[model samples]
Target chain A: MNFYDGLTFPAAGVIPFEHHRAHTPLYYGIQFNTSGTLRVRINRGREHTLTGPVCFITHPGAFFEYSLAPGERHDFTFFCFAGPRVQEYLRSGLLDLTPMPAAISREHKFVETLRELLRQRELGNYPESVNLLESLLIQLRRQTQISAFLYQTPRLQELVHELRAHPERDWDFEKEAGRLSISTQHFRRIFRRHTGNSPQHYLIQLRLAQAANRLAHSEKPIGMIAAEVGFEDVFYFSHLFRKYYGIPPKKYREEFFV
Target chain B: MNFYDGLTFPAAGVIPFEHHRAHTPLYYGIQFNTSGTLRVRINRGREHTLTGPVCFITHPGAFFEYSLAPGERHDFTFFCFAGPRVQEYLRSGLLDLTPMPAAISREHKFVETLRELLRQRELGNYPESVNLLESLLIQLRRQTQISAFLYQTPRLQELVHELRAHPERDWDFEKEAGRLSISTQHFRRIFRRHTGNSPQHYLIQLRLAQAANRLAHSEKPIGMIAAEVGFEDVFYFSHLFRKYYGIPPKKYREEFFV
Candidate 1:
């Protein structure tokens, strides 16, 4: 079935005190809890609490229900897919997902991914949207530890994961390879093959990504942020950041945080 | 800057053979040709031809150039995002995307996702649109082997993938759960907990979804489609299809396919 025929992306927002009653089997939903606490139930199932930075999946015809905890205002974003596949998945027990992205970092990633998905959809990139929905499912599963591996050398993947987890780490090719029990020469070759970039280049990119995230989302000082991302010389960091990002770090942060 | 601040979902359609000459940096573009062929160039870069079901990203400030391939009628969808993030990503080589989703299936998914994005935007779901755009980038990166995964138990995710990919499969719980090295009883329990439905119910939904898609997209006979989607009894399929879709199979086809 063409996935588009029955698909729907309802405006995402808050639902007040009253809960949504059970409806017919029609749409599948991914709901992210953005604020406060959301309490949900499927049919006569036990109540589940959805804290901030968490998400849950709902199948069609599941007698679904949701509401904010008493005295709390609820905020959420939902992406709904309608059609037989959703129903089928629901019936097969594949549509049952709950409270995803248990960690703060992963939750942030999930929210960012959803934001991009919405952007593409708004631009009329239908095919890209479908791919993104698939992407989102995979991301959720990765958090669940279901083995969603990037097609890279295991050692390189491990290094990249670490870099993402802790961008402040002083990472070098020799050090990374040693930690992975591999030779530096082999590591460089495989890393380039998988990432299409030299190890140093990849590390720089990771650090910049971290910096960008921080500059946009936090009130940290630019020099402090540079140091946090492992730039010993704030001047060099600003120069490289300007050269690569098309603007000085201070300007970039001003454009976003201001 | 907010990604949405300078974004524009240009009306999706076509641009004539008159080439778009490069000018001062303004918008970033992700264009998909749904039909015919389009030829484009960045600055004096090599000519790139975009055929049906093809996509390309053009950065700002590269003296962008494009035209229809000789003797071809070009129809396309263009998603233009402006502002500093686009420029920054471009300079950093993060936005140098070209002819993405080379595979037909993936290309189709990308288009569908974009359509939904547009729908949300038209409804003034600005926040949702932003989220979806972020999602699309993640999806594209995942496809590039940067990573993508599905959230759910492996066995269940696989089954759902199969149903989505080939809904006509003669799916049954006993057979499917067995294929996953599990017992029917355990499978049923788990499936309900996850999906809130029995396995048999899910397969029926898949068949119906397939039928709906075929009815909307093809000129096939209702009976043929019913059988094709695993309904041995045409009358029964028609009845069930009508109950779910609020229209008879023949009428539904006429309303959509015609």
Candidate 2:
């Protein structure tokens, strides 16, 4: 069956709450923790604390309750959707509507998609809304898989976080492995296993991503952006960007910069 | 059958050409005109000129050729995808792969989705790529329907373009209809039939959309944004914003602004 069909979104919104709780939602829900922290209990089981930039799902009649600490406001996007396809997916084990949340590595992308979804829905654009919902679900699923693997390798997770935060920093794989007290070869193996990219490749991708963001959002010069993203050679940076993005930096900026 | 499955994207890229022409492709192609105009002729039929911010699809084994003007560089994103599902859709009359292109009303959203698709493909994220591709196709289909209606009402189409360009202006529907030598009642009826929204509602949505874009991109005060978007009362603007976006402007900015 067509994946985009048969799913109906009854309601969705960006909401805020402080010390509030709700029980047993009538429909299946997908919640994105955008700010602060939220605690959710499924069927009175162990409470799962979801921090900002994470997502979790709740099934219909799951007896789930979520709340925030007193005086601490939590901002989140909640989507209520239900249909025969959702039921089929649930029954076939295609969807895991567990209470545990998954960390979102690309918060900006997640937020952008949600914003677009809201815009489409407001316009009564059904096709766009269904497509965006599917994209959001796919992103959540990918994040869940990544989080599961990262949970087993805490050190590598921290390293990955640092890499994302400071792609401009000069990173030496040997030094990173040394800090982790593992051989470089072992570090490479485990890093790839957990992140699906080698240390060098991952760092380069992060730097290129930063450069692309700047190219789209700012009036900064291409060479300056390259330097800011840890690329010492401007020509080499342009070449690499062309290889990755299928266009030259100047052309990309001209075509994409709004 | 899954809508996203069976479609394989063998190669895709952002390319620039000047005074260039190419003949029928081996695979089905979707091309977005990003910069200059593109002229395409299918099966030696009449040429269709697609200006920037439009998209067109090409079928496999079709005798099609496209060209760019001399000394005018055309930048476009080309995606090649083909599979059994595509053939099924074509056979079932589900996809209208005509040579004529459709205008993209929301160019920023279109470009953003394409960028995200490229990012996911680069990362080897299959699910995200599939979702994005499906979203893109759905958007194209919607655009085709809209263009067909808008093409029949050139006067109203011009008005719509002006409204989109300057939503902050005080718009009088009666005067707009008078300019086209039509009654206000008739204008509302035809506009709603063609655009799926009354003129007043459409203008308000445009204004609200402008305000939201400002909130996400600039650090301007909320009141200034409201005034800039033709809202005389900041409180009224905030109320409408909340009702439309499901969040206060302040919270939306705090949660979404990068």
Please name the candidate that would achieve the greatest lDDT relative to the true structure: 2
| Fraction of native A-B contacts kept, per candidate | 0.00, 0.25
Misplaced by over 4 Å in model 1 are A1-25, A84-105, A115-125, A146-258, B1-258
How would you encode candidate 2's per-residue C-alpha lDDT over B1-258 as one tens digit per residue?
Answer: 132456655456676664554566655777787767778788888888867777888776678677777567667787666666776556533366862777788889788888878777655455567677777776676677567656655688778878878889989999999998889998898787555578988788778878877887799999999999999999999999886765689986764453
Predicted complexes: DockQ each: 0.02, 0.13
When just chain B is superposed on the true chain B, each candidate scores a TM-score of: 0.43, 0.56
Residue A124 in candidate 2 has what lDDT?
52
TM-score of model 1 (CA atoms): 0.31
lDDT of each: 0.59, 0.74
Model 2 CAPRI rating: incorrect
Scored by TM-score, the top model is 2
Model 2: per-residue Cα lDDT over A59-169, one tens digit each: 666787788766666677877667776765566334667527777888998888888888777665655776777777766766775676555455877888788899999
Instruction: Write the residue-wise lDDT of candidate 1 on A1-258 in tens digits.
Output: 122334434222233443444443344566676667666777767887657666767655567677766566655666666554444444533334544333223666578778877776554344456556655764554444322223334455666666657767877779778876778897787666444357787677667757866896789898889999989999999888775666788776664342
True contacts kept of 1: 0.00
